[model samples]
Target: MIWDAVIQPFADFGFMRRALLGCVAISLGATPVGVFLMLRRMSLTGDAMAHAILPGAAVGYLVAGLSLGAMTIGGMIAGMAVALLSGFVTRATALREDASLAAFYLISLALGVLIVSTRGSNVDLMHVLFGTVLALDDAALILLCSLASLSVVTLALLFRPLVLECADPQLLRSVSGLSAVTHFVFLALVVISLVGSFQALGTLMAVGIMILPAAAARFWATGIGGLLIAAVAVAILASLSGLLLSYHYSLPSGPAIILVAGLAYGVSLVFGPAGGLVARALPRRHLEA
Candidate 1:
């Protein structure tokens, strides 16, 4: 009975199988991007960029009526624009990066809502906001798989430059003139990952898998490699748990997955080895003569 309850959903339903695959693909690709975002202290930037893609997706819906290719292209364009524009603003103005990001995402979100209001029904809007993970078809799967492959490869090639740039921008620039190229390319990869994930997690909640797992991993891992491994593991587990919870409890799959990741994050916060609440709360001893 326990086995049937827990495992039968995927065994019985093709949609469930597809959804699981989609989540796993997303975790494989997006969680690493999340790790980079966390290391750059740009977690909030991921959230902002996620929102910035909305208007473009809404425009795609208006143009193509839920066409996967159209929305993906549009979202990618919008996200890249916001990222570049925000970077330009940070360099050009006294306003900090966070402030610029906040300003841009708000405008983007409002524009998206207005566009959806004028062009689409409430149901369409909800689908964009929450996603249709269980309804993923062949085209969606192909897009996600391709995106994951590309993101992983790109990250591997750029790893050294990215690390150098993050660690010391001046030093990296002095060593090579690839600093600007590296920054933009990294931003592009982030946008692609978010676009790929939008179908499973929606634009609003897409950052959950990326940020949450990476954040939890920070609590447990002292080194960058360990952090990436821990984050990917957490994301995969959360995806599985969320899918099962959604199946049995009749919950929304995207939110369910995010909630599971959130639960993991909470547990890590309390008991993680690095700097958890328990670690902080434990009494310290002094050396005696």
Candidate 2:
């Protein structure tokens, strides 16, 4: 019964297997970035960057139809451009990083939608906005797995400096010249993860897989390492559940996966032990005299 309900779907369908693999890769790569974004209080920044990729992707689609390489490259270029430009604006002007990012992303989003609508059909627009996980080809799968591997390794190298930066940016800048480098590199990782995942999750919903699990994990764990682990676990579980739901009910895979992750976040908000509603609501024990 369990096999038919849970395991057989992947076993029987190649597309299901591919979709699972793609989601797992996103969970591994993007969730860690999401964790760091949350720690840095830049959660909305992820959403902005996600939107920033859309115009580039739309341009790629306009030029090359649906060529994965073109779209992925365009997305990376666009995301990096926005990140760099935002950083520049923040440093050069009185504007904050978040504000700069918001401006760029909104512009990018509108421009992207306009480009796509001008050139492509509503179906193409839907694909760019929502993704086609079950239709992942070999090239897309390779791209997702390769990017995930690179993200994991890069995060491992950046772990110490990143933690320090998050906890005490002043201290890190004082001690190490790598502060700026680490910041840009982390942004690059974010861009790469989003570009790679946009193929499977689309521009609009890709950040959901990245951010929601990390948010949910916040309520479950205190340590950075624990948070990373818990977030990845939550993401993977949501992916599985979402894929199954989509298969059985004909739901849109991207939104379905995000909805499942959102559900997990809601549950953790209420029941998680770290600082969840239940924990906060419980009465404290009296201290001994």
Candidate 3:
């Protein structure tokens, strides 16, 4: 029966179907964002923004009582605010990047929890920490898909400038003709990743959707395009497996999904085609020949 749960996640169950769709849609948006995050040294931005969405989402629920659309919009606003604050903190303080990131995630989460205390809703706080995939629905599916599509389209158009600016922010002034539009566009992509993934992974761990896969893919590929392809494939496959495993075993879906992604990252750490431990070790022996 446990095995059947894995194989049958796509069976006639509505919950299972929703989980699968969420996995697919999330990866579609997150993969490119993951690439950019990896390049920009802002991977934690996803994590920070995810937590920041919480207060807004909870407040929206207080106002409207579980209308997902309102809740999500609120979450998006909060996410945008977090992104801006992260940048502001980094700039205005002598604090290091990691310090600023920690401030954003921890403080925002505390604020969210405080607001939730006032709402009188029994919405499981644990469920927010680790999402409940079985509760997914058509409205969420549409929203996630639209966000993903917008992310992909915008990224494709701004790919070159974004990559260039990420490599050298100083080029903003030097490139005479190049607008710093790439920075704005990349922020927009991060927003979509946060918004699109919130329902699946919630505010706590959703950054895994935008970080783990890329981290894993780094071992297997060198070029940006190749790394992105590997990242997308790993994220989708892990998400698919994790959702099914969680549904069958009654585990928390979001963390379970992230665990799967982490496992993939571990695998790449040890066995990836390019930079795995084995790959580095193998070259030494061959050189001795």
Candidate 4:
């Protein structure tokens, strides 16, 4: 009976199966990126970049009228621009990267909203904001698979440099001239992950899949390897639970998925084995003893 209730929707509907596959693919690609973001102390930067991609996507929607190819290209362009520009501004001027990123993302968001309003209706705007996960096509599936492959491969190649850069930027610079390349490549991966995930989770909520799972994992794991593994596992579990909840209760799939991630995050906060409230509190209790 439990199996039937939990497994019936996906078994009966092709859309449910596709949604699960898409979410799983996104989690695989995005969760590891999220780990690096967390380790780098740039979680909000990921959120800002997600917004920065909106203008390009909105412009694409305006020009191509819902063509996936156009929107994906536009979003990638805008996301990369914001990332590079923010990094450039920080290096070139006295301003901090976070401040510059905030300014750019705000402008980009306003531009996207204005463009979307001028060309499309509220329904169209909602689609851009919330996504159409249940309506994914073959093209979207192929794009998701391609992005997952690209992220996994690139991250593998850049792992050493990226870790060194994160752990000691000055040391990495002294030993290798590829620090800048590593930074840019990492930013590029962030852009790719965001743009690739936009179709399933939308620009607004896409970072949830990336950052939330990673945050939850941080409470449970000590090393980078463990953190990455835990994050991907948590994300896949959340995706499955969220999809099932959405199917049985008629909830919005994207938010449902995020909510599941959020729930996992909540549990981790209280009960995780590493840095959780319970774990931290235990140390205090021992000290008092």
Candidate 5:
């Protein structure tokens, strides 16, 4: 009965409700990961981890025949495997993170594509690159929620140590008992979050939202807590707005949300109050002496 006209899009139906909830969950869990990813200069690698989830999903679908539990387990394994490989290569050789990331994803993607083609489930390709949000069922919702909750806990407990390592790896290294090992483990968790969320936002756009909002937040804030708040707030608003726009216009939700986030990034670039273009260009703020 024109519920959207009266209420928010989030209340239009179970589908919209779950979609919004999923996005909100991701916003809370992934935004902080974005902050630390940026701090590590590994900002652009989230997409690879997302795409790296494809082969796992494919294997999951084939072996368990569309069971969400199996697919999640499979995808988690695949993501961890990729993260492990990247960590191993970086630790062993002179090759940098970018090179290792490229190698891992390219190979994993090729394998996934081949497997999916052989299984005659080409539609899964779309799910791999961009997930079907309207199709999510109760089980998937539960899984997403659980993962989000667990991630929040991990982030809370490890917040300080992770930051210390990100900001000053060498200094942290000198202290005995604390290894770069802990930092590597944390990055694996980040990859797991990306994989778990691949169904809602896809690999490409997931990284965009994950990294962009946090980046925009960093233009002004001095405190990590404040910056996290700014990023999470912006992410939630952008996600909900983007979802409503897409539903009304019959557009793809993933790209729509990412676009809104990209727009925020553009605005921040031009006018975000500190180091942004407009912030730098116009007259400085005048204060009474």
Candidate 6:
């Protein structure tokens, strides 16, 4: 009976199957990037970059009226531009990366809302902001899977440089020319992951899937490999649970998935073994004298 409750919806419904597949693809690609973002102390940067994608996607909606290719391309362009500009401002001016990114994303958010409000109904705006995971078409699913595959391969190739850059950026710069290249490539991966997922999770919530599971994983593991595995595991679990909840309760699917991830984060914060509240509060076994 329990298995039927968990498994029947997907078996009976094609849309449920597609939504689950898309969410899985996003978790595979985005969670690892989120782990790196956390390691680099740039977790908020992922949120800012997610907002930066909105204006471009809105413009694409204006021009093409929800064409997947146009919106995806536009989001990629906007996200990359904001990332590069923020880096340039940090290097060229006195402003820090966070401040510059915040400014640009705020502006981008306002512009996006304005554009969408003028051309589309409130429902359309809601769709853009919150996404319709249950309604994913074949094209969107293909894009999600393809981007996930690309992200995995590229992250594997860049792993060493990324770790070096996170640990000792100056040493990485001194030792090899890969420092800047790796940084930019990693940003590209972020953009790709965000853009591909926006079709399902929307701009406002896409970064949640990226950041929350990774944050939860931090409390469970110390090493990069462990973090990656843990984060992906949490994300996949959240996706499945959230989809089932949405199916049974008529909840919004995107937010349901994100909320499940958030719940995992909360659980890890309190109960995880590494640095969770319970672990810290518990008396440590006295080290053998």
lDDT: worst 10-residue window of model 4: 280-289
Tens digit of per-residue lDDT, candidate 2, span 125-229: 889888999999999999999999999999999999999999999999999898888899999999998998899998888899989999999999999999999
lDDT of 3 by residue, 1-289 (tens): 8556666667757788888887788897877798789878888776676777888787777788767787788787776676667666776888766777677768777888888886645554665555656788888888888888888888888887887787776776487455445655676578768767877787666789779999998998899998889899998998898887787788888888889999999999999978799888887544654
- The per-residue C-alpha lDDT of model 4 at residue 12 equals 94
Task: Say which prediction, candidate 4 or candidate 5, comes out ahead on TM-score.
Answer: 4
Clashing pairs in 6: none
The candidate maximizing lDDT is: 2
Residue-level error in angstroms, candidate 1, position 269 = 0.5
lDDT of 4 at 39: 95
Q: Mark the 10 consecutive residues where model 6 has the least summed lDDT.
A: 82-91
Candidate 3, residue 179: CA error in Å? 5.9
lDDT (Cα atoms) of all candidates against the true structure: 0.92, 0.93, 0.78, 0.92, 0.78, 0.92
Off by over 4 Å in 4: 284-289
lDDT of 4: 0.92
Off by over 4 Å in 3: 1-7, 86-106, 176-180, 284-289
Report the poorest 10 consecutive residues by lDDT, candidate 5: 3-12
**Model 4: colliding residue pairs:** none
> What lDDT score goes with residue 184 in model 6?
87
lDDT of 6 by residue, 66-150 (tens): 8988889888988998888877888789998889989988888888889989988898888888898999999999988999999
The residue-by-residue lDDT of candidate 5 on 114-194, one tens digit each, is 988898466666676787666678888788788878878888988877887877777778874455666666777687677
Point out the worst 10-residue segment of candidate 1 by lDDT.
280-289
Q: List runs of model 1 lying over 4 Å from the truth.
A: 283-289
Off by over 4 Å in 2: 284-289
